[model samples]
Target: MTTAATSTTAAAAVPFRFFDVHVVRTRLLGRSMVRITFGGAGLTDFASGGRDQRFKLFLPHPGQDAPVVPTEAGEDWFPQWRALDPATRGIMRSYTVRAQRRTDGGAEVDVDFALHGADATGHTSSGPAARWAARAGAGDRAVLLGPVEPDNAGVDFRPPAGTDWVLLTGDETALPAVAGILEALPDGTDARVWIEVPHPEDIQQLDTGAQAEITWLVRDGADGPRTGLIPDAVRAARLPDGTGYAWIAGEAGTVRALRRHLVGDRGFDRKAITFTGYWRKGATEEQLVEEALSGTGPADD
Candidate 1:
């Protein structure tokens, strides 16, 4: 591993590529959230654009010790990785760059995982990514496909210029990105945020300099079904006036409902609201990707 601190200057102008990284540490941020920090020699070239920055993490499959580092570069990497035998391919998942920092040891990136709930039998069952996070330890390796340039234009958080206020809404899966966006907002900027989580203990203390009004909604024990909680909360909240941008992400159905409420009921411009479905109720990420390839999945944006 590299012991030098990451450079603060601009990153080299390079295309996005795969970086082999190892777990530096893991910690519990909340009842259902585990933060895993990754660092390695390849992180020296890792550049983060902050707000809602996303990357593909290739995690080791069951019984495997580490992810197979793909040899192809740029656009060829995905095709090569896809062509591998299913039994040998690593589990690929999308995640947000919660934050990145330069430490005395090297550059480190944080990715937070939301632990899934248990079945009716009361036994805990999590997805592959969450299970990996739960058991991951120092020195465990994975592969990250992300931007090598600091200001990579692929980042999704593009609030229009002259935005007087901001509205942010999402579920547990989007917490990291929402937190990163809040922290990156200009100090004293007006913002409203609503985050829904599985448990009340999942509410975390977000460090943001923005003038943010935050509301946390607990869903696991809420009255009625959990499906409509997010949209209900959004429907009841008072929106701010003036030209503003709204960033909404969560389950596909809920995200669509919120977007419709903003555009149809609230009279906000469709172009001004940015929405994404982080996941669906029963659909896995792989399934969603397959559906997207076939033009059957929910709109990514």
Candidate 2:
């Protein structure tokens, strides 16, 4: 029972590590998104295979050279950080590492930011990190922390040998993670993915090594409100028979709902599913972390 579709083993690969870096380049990738690339000496030690790893981005004050946060020089950085006034600590946003490359004497990481508009995290207004991403350019420097260590970073995603079925669900925030999963699946993996996005145009085309039956659920325009669409889609999905894992992520409510539906309503093994609430509807990045630490979020919606 170690097929590419049913295995529960953690990735045998070494876990990607954290590093500090500086912004080397930044630009607009879409009407409402920006792509920033970072590089520096510390990046040289950054571990590989960080495709879906989350990172903490630290931005310096508008014209400051170095950030005010304690460096690795401190033994209890996070505790010290927790004691600082939120407003004075600057802002930190959670983002996925879209891609990475190492060459010469440095490494580079690319991150995509959804520009603030009618819909966005909203903390982008005066937050140092947000403002930096909004207008960052070459020659700018900032601290890049993470490759957030997942509690189970090395988990191998292959299915058990006898299984032939699967279910996948997530939103734009989780797309990169889902995409990473999809890319790792073997050919002919019998899986169906339900993806939710703000607009039809937000749908990204991906290339996967596995055979996947994918469905896109658009939010807002013409597709009705996103609401409970992710779980609804999964509820109505016709997955192949046999054991499989259910992967879900995104906004807190949506992820909770899908997790409940899969394991609670459908009777799947709770341990067989991977669910993550990447962010919240109205919570800022700071609030999201506080909530996570407090272990408070709506019951798996």
Candidate 3:
């Protein structure tokens, strides 16, 4: 076995707080990805933990003008928000921080949204989060609950001390996170990445100096089940030799399948892999959260 790198360091710490931000602009990153740029006064204290850092976005429902931000006095924000009428309480969604930077005005963060088409019934129906991103414009405000300091436990990408190589696999929903992880890796770090998207145009240029070999699998109108493409591609590829760390995410079922393949068939140590179900095929994020709270969510180890 190849020896692991001995000089890797942990990410810097950051604080966690809530902020109210407004959309500065929106742009199409690819055929199925929309990049929304947000900025506001609250972002003055905003800090990001680089790789796979997640934040909660409170989006307004239709007919509501803006998201209703809860108080930060205590940890009752969730209960307080839930106490409000369902129609007016706004929806909460989780997303990865694609990029963050400080400007002359304040700070700005980019959030990439994956656009999905209509359901099996052919009715034009998308989830609330996707719908909000699709119609969001400049000046539209949303409440962001994220880190205000640099030393919190919000980030999820934790590579072990002896990790010499990396394997990253995911679908469109995990693209931003995967990109962030790749960019955070040191130069000369060996990594193999596999990302599955709905369209060939979804492949965007990644800015990273790491020694990475990326394979983008475009599932354009595949006849059979679509979820298997990512795992199939991962199963076919040959992994590099080393004490490797693998990060996998995307649809819940596929994530589990890929984890089994890595641990069972490929002989990767279960402790060496970090997997998360970003979303389930038919279930909503709300349901997934409920499952997690009940201690039944997909395992990350």
Candidate 4:
């Protein structure tokens, strides 16, 4: 029962530790996303669980040199963080590991952030994380609560044995996870994927060995409206012939709707589908974290 799928579903805390990482470089991955490469001597021990690996990122306050995380508290860091002054405490957010590399210089991890700034209509909707990432530079410091083991609880994209094919759905928020999953898939595996982005330029070349049919849906397309683009696209398609496992993540509402469609209309086995609402519309990360800590909201959707 100690399979990769079971590892994430288990309630046991993941084997994670805190690391003081710094931005080594940044690259504009697309119009609405940026990839920040983090490196440090501490990263030598920072293991990435690969596909869809989730981790907590702590960014510094405006005037701080590095994020103020009580890493010395060890397993009790969360409670310590809660007790700190919110004004000076590090801003916390969750992100997926796009890739991990061990170059001659040192070990590095790439995290892709989705920029949600206002469109051409002159509005301000970007969150603290997005704003910070937009201006992040080389040598910027942050704290990371990342895995120390390769088979930790953070990696969630696990399809059971004998899975004939797989279905993946994600919006811009889940793009990093989806890309990681696609790259980790076994060669010749059948994968049906749908990705929604803010603009056509947001799409990128993804490397995968699986027989994946990836459809990119742009929200700003002049041809049509954007509501339910992924769901509608999947519904209209002819799925591969076999039992399927689905891993979905994106906007909360859309994720739920697509899950219902798959279970009710497509008749997929409920247990075979792993869904995560990476974020919700109009909800701040602080609010979600508060709810999660107080046990008042849904856990990992």
Candidate 5:
């Protein structure tokens, strides 16, 4: 059931399309970030226009030959992944589609992974993602699942239909999604963005037609949850006088606080704010979602 403000969809029924692609290029953007570009025959079938969507990456098991991917459906890959025993199956993590390029003029998905530590597998401290990324070559095979398009199109939280301004807030974890949102905005749109990062170097410039005021909040010396900077930044922010929307993402507690400050304290229209807790500090994705939706709710910072 969908109200005027909210629409309920069968999340599980959403198609989980898979793609088998070959790594075409690799670039290290920073100490913790790596960009891998992939393309192949399977790439032709991938849908374009989903810059901000996310998908699951299935890494080949250690020392195993590249797995074959079925073009029609993804069920073939699941059994092989499950055969590794519950403990040995490679870790599957969610990553944003940074950019997409296609020869047919469709779209190719560009994914940037935070490779700060070990790969996904526990055999090494680093997870499998890092290990695979480190050794990835131009011809390596990768199977991608659920490049599900996000549902937030035309859903900006700005007050009044087609407002002139917006405020964006998030952490490093939300950078890819933030970039996509900014890219999708109309030219000459006016907006302000405040991003919290570990250091000043993490501030990457964005290309958006919107008149954007981006503030980078550094967390180098912060001891508590890295998201504490959002509250202070928002407090100091000077939003446009006209109707504006508020968007906040990243850590769970931080997002919750910003939500309250806007709708609860500042009295922004309830429909004028969108906040998503992408991930928690010390919890897995499943655990974070469970805690967030559970009646007990996630703990406060």
Candidate 6:
């Protein structure tokens, strides 16, 4: 009964539909990240809203060739999927769209996965999605709850009109979205970016027309404790003058602190900042899903 109510609420969300996709290829970005490309006839209608576009991805369990999603429920698929036995049901996760391109065969979408835990091989400490991403290959099947229209609600990196500058910060888990946002910034847009990664190799070359200065914070080579590096860096920097919009994501606690710092200490209006907690430290995605179900809630974008 509770699941039915939850599903009804979630199902009413607009402009998203399920599409079946299969992996076309994979690339190792670094020791801690991998990029997977998915394509099929179904992706012909997959329209990405670009910058920070997010979607739900479902993967199969061990020994299963395809994810066991109850798409037959149609628009109310969420409830049916929720009722499946955990061990037999599909593994659902959220991800950001890095890019969408056309090839001779069809349209393909690129998604970058941050490999956490022991190392980039993604063999240790990774949940289902990371492990699947690390080992995924051409022909691997999955399902995506993606947008059909270019202008959809799945994207969240909106800087309101007349913003003079922008500040963006995140850890590796939020890097893909940050890259997309930077790529979409207008020419000469003053932008400041901060990114934290476990290793230096995880740093990416971001190309953007915006007048962007990006600072990469590497945990492995830091002088002091790896903790609070981003907050410390932001505190010591001189921000550009004028109206600024901020987007901060990653560990929930850090995100809250940064948001508080921006609003309380930096004197920025709360309305000028967009904050999302991609993940909470020490909490599994499953736990997060449960929280959402129970209305404790954070449905990250």
- Model 5 bad stretches (over 4 Å): 1-16, 66-84, 88-90, 104-107, 117-135, 147-162, 285-301
In the predicted model 1, the residue pairs found to clash are none
Tens digits of per-residue lDDT for model 6, 72-169: 78778988988889898888888999999887777899999976753435566666787788788899999998988877777777777788999999
Scored against the true structure, residue 127 in model 4 reaches a CA lDDT of 64
- Tens digits of per-residue lDDT, candidate 2, 1-301, equal 0000112345533434335566777765434456788887667665535435555566666556756566653457667766777656635556666777786867787776654332234344433444567766677766765533343343434344566676777776567667777776777777888887766667777778677888988775543223787777888877677888776667766777677777777888876776666666655655566665465644443
Per-candidate local distance difference test: 0.76, 0.62, 0.77, 0.82, 0.63, 0.81
Q: What's model 5's TM-score? A: 0.75
Evaluation by TM-score, superior candidate among 1 and 4: 4
Worst 10 residues of 6 by lDDT: 1-10
The candidate scoring highest on lDDT is 4
lDDT per residue for candidate 3 within 70-125, as digits (tens), equals 75645778778877776678687788889999888888999988867522243346
Q: Output the better candidate (3/5) by lDDT.
A: 3
Instruction: Assess every candidate by TM-score.
Output: 0.88, 0.78, 0.89, 0.91, 0.75, 0.91
Task: Give the residue spans of candidate 6 off by over 4 A.
Answer: 1-13, 118-122, 221-226, 297-301
Q: What is the lDDT of residue 99 in candidate 2?
A: 71
The parts of candidate 1 lying over 4 Å away from their true place are 1-14, 118-124, 222-226, 299-301
Show the lowest summed lDDT stretch of 10 residues, model 1. Answer: 1-10
Residue 167, candidate 3: alpha-carbon lDDT: 93
| Candidate 6 lDDT | 0.81
Better of 3 and 6 by TM-score: 6
lDDT for residue 67 in candidate 3, whole number 0-100: 77
Model 2 ranges with Cα > 4 A deviation:
1-18, 27-32, 61-66, 116-131, 147-163, 222-226, 294-301
Q: Whose lDDT is higher: candidate 2's or candidate 6's?
A: 6
The better candidate by TM-score, 1 or 3, is 3
